[model samples]
Target: MDTASSSSNSTMAEFDYLFKLLLIGDSGVGKSTLLLSFTSNTFEDLSPTIGLDYEKNCWGVVSDIIFLFLYHEAGQERFRTLTSSYYRGAQGIIMVYDVTRRETFTNLSDIWAKEIDLYSTNQDCIKMLVGNKVDKESERVVSKKEGIDFAREYGCLYLECSAKTRVNVEQCFEELVLKILDTPSLLAEGSAGVKKNIFKEIPPQSDASTSGCCSW
Candidate 1:
């Protein structure tokens, strides 16, 4: 993976972000895999996501940018409760889909609209659409144009990513962080909402060496 772009300076202000990001999609949309790549530098293709799972990431930034990571997963029924609980103070939310699974992608709104409403009502939460599993072009069921249009309709940024190849995954996160930075108040609000994680104290070099975790 390419090294993340963080400023040379060291301070909490440089690393702070005002957005809470949540990943929502169908069971097999590679949400967990993507989270693993960003947070722990691990990528494990897992079995179907059952109830719900979560992880967090912290990114270094330059200029006025701050990046924080939030990853969450849930089943069809668990969607309502899980999301309502997690996205309460999110800075941004990423709704993901598998490019090769139209059914999975199609039902995303049905399963997650409530959660979207929860965060959207707060005004601080920005959103983005992510199409996952882009490496499987031959099996692709959704067109890039279609995804972009949907995102635009919802007023969100859109990007297709392949976690397996590490393609555009980092870029997608970067875009979200930069978008949140564009609004400083959101960042200030997120800072108060976000609690520090124990894993963050771990060194970056140590995390890189621990890639590809998760038995799945």
Candidate 2:
């Protein structure tokens, strides 16, 4: 809920906890847009690329610093080899899907989770199922109840967000961070991997007016 210090600006921060999180899903889903939305709080018509995009953000108080290294991987098949490498030592993996694309939603367990299990150092990595571009309610092929049900069955946190509208973007990250903060076992489990955690519950936030861009 407080102003966050971006990775671009926090080169000298004295961080206590460092976590690596990956944004992964189908190629056309808004992983990069979500990253930009969180870090810069703006949206752009970002062209798809094959390389990994990194952003850092610092949260919590000065004494209990939490630094997150966010990696937005290109979802194209050509980048699969490269993106999988980024999964090493990841503490959190956000499996994103386009709400308007039924195929993308269906691929959550079949494609992304399987790939994550293959490369992720921590098998019990914090997982979140994010349905992006909920702003396109008219064209949405995936329903909120369906997303929640799938996430529940998959044992992952679930959220629907709109990166373009900046709705739930902050909450998405905050919820993941809170989950990490609360689970000590997960933090200690990172073992030589590029991840860690803290013990703090994510406080609930009041739902306010807010409003991702995705299509089938």
TM-score per candidate, chains pooled: 0.76, 0.81
Supply candidate 2's per-residue lDDT for 215.
9
Give the Å shift of residue 59 in candidate 1.
Answer: 1.5
Q: Candidate 2, which segments miss by more than 4 Å at Cα?
A: 6-13, 61-63, 188-216
Q: Counting only residues 3 or more apart in sequence or on different chains, how many pairs clash (N, Cα, C under 3 Å) in candidate 2? A: 7
Q: In candidate 1, what are the lDDT values of residues 1-40, reduced to their tens digit?
A: 2333533453444444435577887777888788777666
TM-score of 1: 0.76
Each model's C-alpha lDDT? 0.66, 0.73
Model 2 residue 7 CA deviation (Å) reads 11
lDDT of 1 at 72: 64
